[model samples]
Target: MMYKNSILLGTIGGYRDRFHQFQKDRSLEERLEIAKTIPRTHGVEPVYPQDLGADGSGAAAVKASGLAVSAVNVNIKTEPKFRDGSFTSTDAGLRAETVQYIKTAMDLAADLGTDMITVCPLIDGWDYAFQADHQKQWGWTIEAFAAATAHRSDVKVSIEYKAYESRNHIVMPTMAKTLHLCDRVGAPNLGVTMDVGHALIAGECPAAELAIAHDAGRLFYVHFNDNDRGADWDMLPASVHLWQTLETLHYMRRIGYDGWVAYDVFTRTGDNVEAIASTFEIMEDLEKILDKLGQDTIESIIASGMPQQGYRDLVKGLL
Candidate 1:
């Protein structure tokens, strides 16, 4: 059976504490030696870039330590002290900074042999009045990204959508909305980065959306996390939609989606090491569940006029 290049899952935001607690002031080289030992279904593990104090010892340090870094995620909203009241502010200084940052990341990805980078337009703790302004800011950000990546066809840009956590809300907070933004950006390198957890939180079936995006030719990247209907973001793995996740993987296989499936979660609540290991185990189990289902059986059930509940039962039987 054909599959995407292997599904590469890695920690984006939660390894800092793990490094400090377990490494005991060891250098990043030592920390990466530990990261390399974690068992993964996919051979590649990419770390997200964030500031690491005055020493500049975060992702850059990790990359310098010789562990393979395949992707880098830039959180634009988290930058310090670039306060612009509106997206249209177009402060020459801010634009310059944003452009330079993007270029630097693109260069870093090329250097590391990474194929994609994700940009999240998340704003924190804003009021209703900021919604329109925030949307405009996202538009501007998209334009800036398009301009920055116009010449770099080797690297792809994924725009991730979230519903009401980082900001009071997000403008393009759904797969459909994200597709529209991608159309507006209209760059060859621009595409939607689908996060399964965000889709579940928005009360949408991720499997259905994956099919829709695949049909529309807009699905480029994926993030795997889970949340219950009533819960906030980053709840846990398959907490609300185990069946949906299975269906999602199956659909990706059906549509021949060959892209990265990175894990986007926080490990602050407990032992980060165990949490990461357990999450990988769960993901592997999910994949096995999909494998046992077999594409022909799944397609036959849907064609047989069975209800969605029956579909779930069919998958469970395979499991």
Candidate 2:
């Protein structure tokens, strides 16, 4: 099948973490200006409220940079109040506050001209067994999301699932669990952001997860990064698991995913611009490799169901 390649590229504004040595904290505008300098990126994702600046200056700066607003990330784990949990908190008052916060963020996302908002429940799970009430917490989590999207169905909420980060464990830790949450929430606008690093850490096939979410019609967004199967270091994409990342890209093309593919790399040292540019360069190379592999060859391999034959041809092409 002849396919036209078209995908909007984006990056998280805060991925440019400042290291005490080489990098320093840059204002939101400065970061956005840096993002615009990246050739492949057409947009920058800024976290709501904090990254929006005091008087819409941050959003204005992004606008002035001629880059699109990919999405606004709603941070639920960073604040002290959400240490236990936010959406599924047993503290009713805290849950109320969390719901209100999301609503406010939703409004901000609309104002930013991007209907997408990412919700990463990084603190919504327990580290130990018997620490969380499974049924009750599940209900609360679903209710909070439902309430957030009830008023405005147009604003899509994409939940980014990570196995763990802030807490020893995170709630809704996998695509299957996340898609189940979306179903339970029963909101048309509720979807998911499939982060490749998280998928690798979760021991999941990134390509399969992408296909699953798309089949469910809940694949709202994507974040591309790589990590050793051990931890979410948020390294450059295709850095660790080359073949798996390539296969993931293959499936992305197979499904005709034209949505935003955001680079979600983070660093505590080294030049952030170079890191981002390097990822873009790697992506350019991967795209060329993918072009050479072609959908027809991949399809034939899948059809044959014989791994050795496919491997032989793939090795020949590489050499």
State each model's CA lDDT, in order: 0.63, 0.78
Which prediction has the highest TM-score against the true structure?
A: 2
lDDT of 2: 0.78
State the displacement of the C-alpha of residue 25, model 1, in Å, after optimal TM-score superposition: 9.9
Clashes of each: 0, 0
How far does residue 208 in candidate 2 sit from its true spot (Å)? 0.4
Q: In candidate 1, what are the lDDT values of residues 125-187, reduced to their tens digit? A: 254773455565666766676776684888877767777655566656788877876777787
lDDT of 1 at 230: 61
Clashing pairs in 1: none
Q: Which candidate has the highest lDDT of all?
A: 2
